[model samples]
Target chain A: SQKIEQNSEALNIQEGKTATLTCNYTNYSPAYLQWYRQDPGRGPVFLLLIRENEKEKRKERLKVTFDTTLKQSLFHITASQPADSATYLCAIHNTGRRALTFGSGTRLQVQP
Target chain B: GAGVSQSPSNKVTEKGKDVELRCDPISGHTALYWYRQSLGQGLEFLIYFQGNSAPDKSGLPSDRFSAERTGGSVSTLTIQRTQQEDSAVYLCASSLAGQDRTSWYEQFFGPGTRLTVL
Candidate 1:
């Protein structure tokens, strides 16, 4: 069965440091991969979308890279702040099935 | 000044009772989706509504669950004879269809309705 997996269940880092989260999938080749930030008890908010054709994408303080060959995506938050603490999820959009399949997500905690 | 919205932010029901959850998508959004999040688990796709077409109900867990979108704006998900296992946060999301290819239904989600079948 196709499955998406985030590297860790929880990560803790200093506020000024960088946080990198990894997402790997198996038995599936997705056309596009998206990242979302979800706080406890709230809906997920869209963060970034990287296509299979694009190697990398950036928005403000965040960066995402997609490697179709490796079947993985890496999400990075630079100069992370306490506000960046949340569960980050990576979603895949299979070619014919556009509805996203989300990973379990990695929880990040940035301490000041 | 608007995003996707869902009603009854929290629901508490007894076993064998029926419950209805409603969702109001952003104006003009052609696509709507329902997802269930169990404790510490990833979001599970439940159902999807795209315009007037028949919904993709493949993700629905069982025959006891059904959903409908009326006039392309509002949607309702009904769970019959709710069980304790039915407890979870029910999330609703909407997005514009036929938008940029890269976005590929970049959904805007609503603050989910937390259903507790006690």
Candidate 2:
């Protein structure tokens, strides 16, 4: 069976520090890898997307790196603030499927 | 400029009863999807609809779960004989390109309808 794993433990960081999250998957080759931000009681919002051929992607303060050889992706938030604190999820487009498969997500807490 | 919207922000039902959740996708969106998120769990794919083509029901967990998208816009996920395990946040998402795998369209999710089956 295919699996997408993320650190379930909440990451606590001081304000202005960089927050890094990891997503690992096995048994599937995804064409596109995406990151999303989800808040308590709210649905996830789209973030960054990196294609298999691409090694990295960036948007504003967010950056994502996709290493298909390692079957892992990293999400980084630079100059993080308290408002940036939320659960981050990683999704992948299964080769032939139109829907995305998402990881459980990692929660980040930024303290001021 | 409206995003995806789902009705009945919250629903509570008794076991063995049936419930229907609605999703209204963004105007001009040809793709729609249903997903379930359990407590402390990731989103589970439920169903997918693109254009006027036959929907892909491969993700539905059980026969008790069924969904329909009419006119390629609105969708309804119906759960019959609901069990306690059915309690979760049901999320609906939409994208512009349904069959364009090359495009890799990002999904826009709705606020979600939390279902509590007792």
Tens digits of per-residue lDDT for model 2, B1-118: 8989999999999999999999999898888889999999999998888865645778899999988888988899999999999999999998887466544368999999999998
Docking class for model 2 is high
List clashing residue pairs in candidate 2: none
The fnat of each candidate, in order, is: 0.74, 0.82
- The candidate maximizing DockQ is 2
lDDT of 1 at B118: 91
| A30 Cα displacement, candidate 2 (Å) | 0.6
Candidate 2 structure quality by residue, lDDT tens digits, A1-112? 8899999999999999999999999998998999999999999999988889999998999999999999999999999999998999999997777889999999999999
Candidate 1, after superposition: displacement of residue B2 in Å? 0.8
Residue B27, candidate 1: alpha-carbon lDDT: 92
Which tens-of-lDDT digit does each residue in B22-110 have in candidate 1? 99999988889999999998899998888855457788999999999999999999999999999999999998876575544699999
Q: Which stretches of candidate 1 lie over 4 Å from their true place?
A: none
| Top candidate, metric TM-score | 1
| Model 1 chain B worst lDDT run, 10 consecutive residues | B96-105
